[model samples]
Target: MKFALVLVVIIGVVSLVSTILVANRVEAEYSKSVKRNLTNLTLMYVLLFLVLSVGIVWYIVGVR
Candidate 1:
């Protein structure tokens, strides 16, 4: 679960960053919506990565 979460978040960040860089040239309602969604998704991904990293470290320490 920890590794999966990390992969998911990294992918999300990369994909969103690419989309944002590409979408900057556009001026449309759809572009605005996509930007908004991408921003929110990226925040969620950072939070997930933080939580999973802490949880995994805690689990590992407890096991030993």
Candidate 2:
């Protein structure tokens, strides 16, 4: 349906924009702190992955 198509487009745009923003922020932080502490960086990535995974599942369920 047209509604579903529009929803998909909107979700895709939001995901792309958020991903780029988060990546840029993460890269900046990593560059500054890589030498200071590696554990924090590793934890951040793990948390980010979990958050994204949950978001994807939530979105998929909502769509269905």
Candidate 3:
């Protein structure tokens, strides 16, 4: 679980950096760029849920 959390943190940090780069380069409509940034942020949410689901499965099997 600890390792999984660390992985999520790393993913989040990478996402933040990518967002910075994206914002710096794409100077189009602010609304569209904001939408793009949000879409990227969803990746972090996906990562968190994937880790949580895996941990739940692991607990079910290991603690059984």
Tens digits of lDDT, candidate 3, 1-64: 6687679768777877777676667656686867776677767667776887797788878987
Clashing pairs in 2: none
Rate residue 35 of model 1 by lDDT.
Answer: 80
Stronger candidate by lDDT (1 vs 3): 1
**Candidate 1 C-alpha lDDT tens digits along 1-64:** 6687688668877877786687676767688677887788778767877897798789888988
For model 2, how does the per-residue alpha-carbon lDDT over 1-64 read when each residue is reduced to its tens digit?
Answer: 5577578557756765565465556666575564344545546555765786687678888999
Q: In order, what lDDT does every prediction score?
A: 0.76, 0.62, 0.73
Report lDDT (Cα) of residue 57, candidate 2.
Answer: 72
Model 2: how far residue 48 lies from native, Å: 0.3
Look at candidate 1 and give me any clashing residue pairs: none
Q: Give the CA lDDT, 0 to 100, for residue 43 in model 3.
A: 76
**1 against 3, candidate with superior TM-score:** 1
Estimate the TM-score for candidate 1: 0.58
Candidates ranked by TM-score, best first? 1, 3, 2
